[model samples]
Target chain A: MKDPRLLAVCCPDWPVVAACTATGTALHVPVAVVDGNEIVSTSAVARKEGIRRAMRRRAAEAMCPELVTFEHDPQRDARFFEPVAEAVEELAPGIEVVHPGLVAVPARGPVGYFGSAEQAAERIVDHIATHTGTEAQVGAADSLFAATKAAHRNMIVPPGRTPEFLRPLGVHELDAPELVDLLRRLGLKTLGAFADVPENAVATRFGGPATRQHRLARGVPERPLDKRRPAPELAVTETFDEPVERVDAAAFAAKLLSERLHENLAARSLACTRLGIHARTENDEELQRVWRAAEPLTPRGIADRVRWQLDGWLTRERLTSGIRTLTLEPVEVVDGTALQLGLWGHDDERAVRALLHVQGLLGPDGVLTPVIDGGRGPREQVRLVPWGDERTPTRNPDHPWPGRLTRAPATLADDPAALEDENGREVGVTGRLELTAQPKKLTIRGRTREVTAWAGPWPVDERWWAPDRHRAARVQVQADDQAFLLIRRDQRWFLEGVYD
Target chain B: MSRSATASLSELGVNPASELTSTTTDHATGRVLPVRGELAGLLPWGGLRRGSTVSVGGSTSLLLALLAGATADGCWAAVVGLPQLGVLAAAELGVAVQRLALVPRPGSDPGPVIAALLDGIDLVAVACPLPPSLARRLTARARQRKAVLIAFGAWPSPDVELTAESVSWNALDDGAETLRRQQIAVRSGGRGSAGRAKNVLLTFGEEEIELPLVAGGPDRSDEPADAGPDRADELAARRATTREQPA
Candidate 1:
């Protein structure tokens, strides 16, 4: 394939900058985004204060006492950077976003139309700066790697001079620390020195990745651009005469808007899987966010997403203005055939609405949904968590619970019953894991039942290593018409549950 | 020409207007859902009637057994206030796990919970004892909503009441501690001429508790029985296992 000149537009310290901009933090403040304990990205002010990328958070803070830290959020960066990408897309129709802060585009068409590669780069930089209010650097070269390096210093290399432009750059510019360190040990300090090594020698020494970069340093691109087809604009928008300041009002409005949007999609038998929500405030501020789900959206699902987004924006984002207009867009859609309907004669559509209404009245956690999990104990087997809040259970069911009952009892008694033998004396289990007496009769709620047949003194010893150790013996007794599973813990007997 | 054509259609005892609206009304509100073997014979209509409350008086096993057939046939069942329900046991009894919802501990007043479930769920099995007024309210709501309700214990009023009169546990005879199978004699009585006592002998095998059609006789082979549903379940199980395997 023919190699076309490509231009890369890059914004520095994008994650920290996006976080600061979203929170309205001043640019002059030193800021860094920390992943675990290391700084991933740092603002210009933080960098100037010797707080660099990958620096330990404690070390960075010590260097700059006033350093502000933000948790690294990829979603926040991508969501906030969408406007910048759109601004560049307006000037150069198709730009590939390699990540949050960087975008690359084929310069052949735009450069020829604008008369010069320099003019095309300037146009992109100007549009992004004017529209997104973010400073950007643009560089043009034959390969993405060389173009990215050129963009770091905002230079447009002339055709066939990419290798010459990259020659004086240090090996560190290759962006592979291990390869760079290896090259440095081999006495190769510059890109020109590394490229001078035989291609076969480099392949035998450093393998595939190093060879690909070696090709880039020699002005040859690894491959052509994977051209992207621009997504269609299938967004539904609505404007309110009055601005919505309250979250509940916004949620209600969002629900209605979702219904309107889904009705349009339903006619075409299409359902959106990935959705983008865009909001415009009274002060002319624009906010955009995207939500993705494993399953395609129903009208109710769309409404839940809109409400969740609104809740986060209003409560956590601390926006300066109220929303005046809102738009719901489908970023990706699939045929409705994958959508499953409720079973025969079941009206789940209405049930979901009723449950959601209940959830709203009661707190979100007031209503719960149940899921079956593998476990030994009666209470441990089924997990119940508030609807929409699915979490892993505290107990791991995969482990072998050695002393659990082999057969699950049919019913769990509301409360444990007291047991006694025919002598009208209480039955008990001793420390030796032996029954004190042969269990005979069972009494529950004042009713005494005669036990005709009885089974085990099956002992269970649990958590012997912990402070709270438990020792119990279980027995199966057939009394009157009902068969009961009784447990003796410590010295007393309590009816654990009933067997149906 | 159109008027003569319409007139001819109406004259043939086929009202053109009724034909257009007939499809909507054909969804019978009182239609009975087909159930498994002897349990079918126990009911007056040979199946579970919609908009009715049936009492499963004795065993929770009976409730799970009753749900197995309906849930296997793609009906959704909601179990409320029965926290100790052995859902794994229900799965072994052939109930579709995907179609089951458990609200084991429906706090304080379970009436609203059952009423809400009745609006959509085909069958609701409630285990808690209901006060007379709340029971009346739920029964009326169930009938109006056209959802079948199954109460685990004794209830105030029921269209059909199934009670396990006798339960005999099968032992190894050598006095080994393991208990194998259980045979329950369930008697159904309640409501209109349906009060005629009906008895069913259900045998619990390794996998399922089935009502043998001939009381104490050998198995019959006429009915395709569970083959169709079993194949569907196999396909679903195969799909699930394949998905769990790493690529």
Candidate 2:
């Protein structure tokens, strides 16, 4: 990695300037791209004008009456720079992208091949212009910072001329803005003036990091050449002309997406486990569902989960109305090895399919898996939820979880029932009825029972601070034949759950 | 494709009474029975089958209470479109509302919607305002599919063998609100066309009554003109407020 260098081609108004650039036509950044102090655009001409980006729109318009404003498009910008990255990759396989429009390619082999460093840079810039009809600028230095600075400023300081080239630049180039301003206040502006100052004086003011920078200003780059790595894997999508209401239809579309994803992954021979399904509703509610398969998922599995999650909204649940778009993003991929299928089949995926089928039949909570959390209270410790929906775990597992119950009740009380008194007459039930004390007998369905053993009138006072969601207490009791978990708050006895 | 499942469903014919009952996994052993009806002979099988749709006429509460008895031993049950029913009360009555899903039928796709819903979940009881064709289809499907199909009205279909009707014994028309809110009545009759089972009078919520089979009378007469569909409506209205009986 000898004399490795970095190259950055800034397209200040790439989206605004890319239609012609994509096909190799336009190259210059638009005038008035920047509105003020800010680099509102990559336009070289815009930088010369006082107009900067994001300054008062009126202010920008006043400076340049015919200035064109273009909406930013990441896709177009990426497409515009693809040839540039490819051109660099052609020179050397080792390349890294800092951004869609900025890339760094190693200059060692290419420089050596083209005779000398200057000749190599000139030939490469010529190649870039021929391939991508844009004025190509090349900068060569021992370090990426120096190379980037040279290209950004459009200077071609020859190989061994770095120290002399940096001598006249201001000290602020080395990131000592405060010190540079202080020196300028005292009427010292250039790097040569700073180099003339005692090294001890500079060290005493700016500390250790400043001393490191002092050496770099003498044209010595400290950054090491990095081994080339492939660009990050990303999934892309397109919207539909019409809304889709069926789950299978979404899966069908996602299958098409899977092909695109496979193409991207196969290019690098990689796979991922985590997938993201993004659905944009007609009402503009951006709903995102993430698929986290325990193992690598086939396109079908991805599609099924995507469809079911879409089922959670599009078909199964009522959407606001129409759908605007859909997106399937395999956000995270895993390093997967080729599987050697030992037999005609593997583990049964059919069981899970059947289980999901039955659950759909038996309402939501028909089939449940028992989940145990770190809670002392029986009810809080164990939760029996349908299948998915792991969102509402028993909270406060670490605290002395109260009450004595088994799994969380399969059903929640939609409306508070009228608790009956001893005579089976309706009584008042304003809040959660928790029996602070053990009831002597629990009569259910006109059948009276005895309370054999009991745990607590554990005051489960959750969200006492939140006025809307104030739950009180639940006391667990064991009878001769049955075990009941009783809940109470404002002095009443009603069973909330069972132990079986 | 394997043809076993469909054949098995056909082998197990439908029973009327158990159409809306859910099976409970016995607490002691986890043993599960497909149906549990205390009075099985009242329906064809003495058990309600899964996937069947049944309709019972008159009040919605009767169907709920009947289902409550079938599910009391820990079975699961579901009731669709009992619009006035309080689900929590059903849960407490031991009818596993957690195992239940109440579908809202605000419009009239009453037949198809109900059938499609039954296709997914076990149809315990569907409280619907069904027409004759829908009622007939539900009855026929319940028998073949081994599911219990019940309609809300006593509009009998040839598919039904036994029917329980709860009626208010003495609810006379008055210009005012209920003069009396006591004394419920019930009557049980089977195979009006076949003419076998008798009316079992039950003074509900009081002392029980016995069965006295009487045909060729106004209530169960062969002649449709004596009391047609309009009479059925009048009978239904009278049964709503007054106490009920079984024949």
Candidate 3:
């Protein structure tokens, strides 16, 4: 069957452009966006200076010392791209954002209106450049995958010619790294080579995901775009008694609405790939946009999209009032059997639901899960992340940190305390790790106790190069039945933890 | 009377028959989450019984220890309203930290939050004090959901109550060694099978605690302490073996 022709708009290095636009950095300046330690995207100027994607940040900096770098934030990129998507939507309605940098629409409406596919692409690209002041390329082909690839090269493949256009592309264009590597090892270096393999043989050798990629290689849709029409009741709407004027408020509402939408979809064993967000302003202005993804949207993914969209709308000067009504509707769905509960069993699902319920009651940051992180202090060693957020630790735990405590206290305290010697003089640690007084009495929160046992002053000097350097010495002292970890900093002793 | 004859007589009376059937069914289907080492002997049921409230008083380490075995056995546990909880200590005590969630500061009213957690989590340990009415309601909720509710502070009418009577820190001197191990004496008492007061000695070493495997008396000498992760694995393996034995 012939796949439906689609038109896709692509903005090269959108992250760099969005970063530049958000920070008001001129486009001529060399800029790169980094995720963690690696560069994700670079502006044209940086690319000219040999800064490539996946290059280490230090290498990029070493190559071009004047290059400005910004941490890659998807929400910021999406917020900046909203104007570009809006520009295209003015020329052609029913736009579906493939991601922050790309948007796709059915070619029939734009081509029929513009009289030719080339004219439609030209008009959309010109409209975006004029309205949003961003350079864009438009491509038209039989499938979204083919259209996206064509847009990257600014080409419009003629009707029924997508297979020819995709034939010479490298297998890396498939975007499945492992599958592409295996195909390259098997001498299928190009998409055409991979596509030439027999369908039954490919299905037997390769698995389900590979089969879908094989379809994309052959210029066929990965699956028949069923675009199931979700039940009207599946659309979740929330009417704010006090209109949401702040981004944080909207984000909280988005999390709740997305959870409800996901629950409704999961009940029917469906997952949304395309979502439509609708909002009504207090002044009776209505606004809407649609977002599409290659895979089904998880709850967090849906919430992020809603938040980015709302942030774009709320921050822009077009809206005169706050949003009064918000709605989330699944535009396209698919069988969600793959999204079923994990092998950990049904209790996990129930627990997740309960946690989500509490999150709804007390906001997302209310319920948290702990991750053991790398640090010298007990409080710094454990990072508490919100229930549904990523559980990645900020610092790597494997690095051997000197002067760390051998045993962690069962409880942590931040109370102010006084450590004094028997002579009634306050004790202190000298700069050379010398204690001014050996014997001491501990006074904590108005209660004084005699110190029975004592330990050394373990000094920690961190971030000595920066202006906010911290220099503190820790001591373990036992007073009566209680043992406390005390830190002497800025000439005062404060209780850090309790070994209960 | 013979067992068969008593059963026949009960079957002749409708009320007695239904009551007898309910009691037998409840006993047969009662689920118990495993506890670690010798700690099991302190509880009447030899484990944490589902739908029962167990309160731990005066010891945060004991509360964390109670959650370790069940979490390692694949049970989800959550702690509510204890912001100062030492998660690192919990990890060192063999709790599967990944399966544990913390609602550290649930604000002034933590009743709804704890109740919601009780609905989903297999075991919930709450340190916040709640009103008597809310506490009773939460207990009923836990019972309905077949979850274990662990109260950290004073609670009314719990199925089992554990208190730390004496605690001593080991491996510390005037100026030499650091604080390493701890010895705690925990006393348990409650209603029903747990009504009789019992005491157990738990030695918390650097990595994992040494609990006496036998219930005779507190034996603190000569038993080697295993590392935290290996002890968890051993407990998980033992649980698996126990589960398969019944099948």
CA lDDT, candidate 3, residue A3: 42
**lDDT of candidates 1 onward, in order:** 0.67, 0.45, 0.79
- Rank list by DockQ: 3, 1, 2
Residue A127's lDDT within candidate 3 is: 91
Model 2 chain A, poorest ten-residue lDDT window?
Answer: A338-347
Model 1 gets an lDDT of 0.67
TM-score of 3: 0.69
Q: lDDT tens digits, residues B109-151, model 1?
A: 6777778778767888888888988988888888998788898
Query: On a 0 to 1 TM-score scale, where does candidate 2 land against the true structure?
Result: 0.30
Interface RMSD values for all candidates? 12.4, 22.3, 10.4
lDDT of 2 by residue, A420-499 (tens): 44455543323323222323566555566665554433335423224465445544444554444556545455666543
lDDT sort, best first: 3, 1, 2
Every model's TM-score: 0.49, 0.30, 0.69
Regions of model 2 farther than 4 Å from truth: A1-290, A294-325, A329-500, B1-38, B49-54, B58-61, B65-78, B106-108, B154-186, B192-247
lDDT of 2 by residue, B1-247 (tens): 1222322332354323323332333312322223322223233323443433333444433455456544454343445455444432233223543334444332455555455434433344666566777766766665554444555555454323334443332232221111121111223343432234423222222222211111111344344432323332232233332333421
Clashing pairs in 1: none
Q: What are the per-model numbers of colliding residue pairs?
A: 0, 51, 0
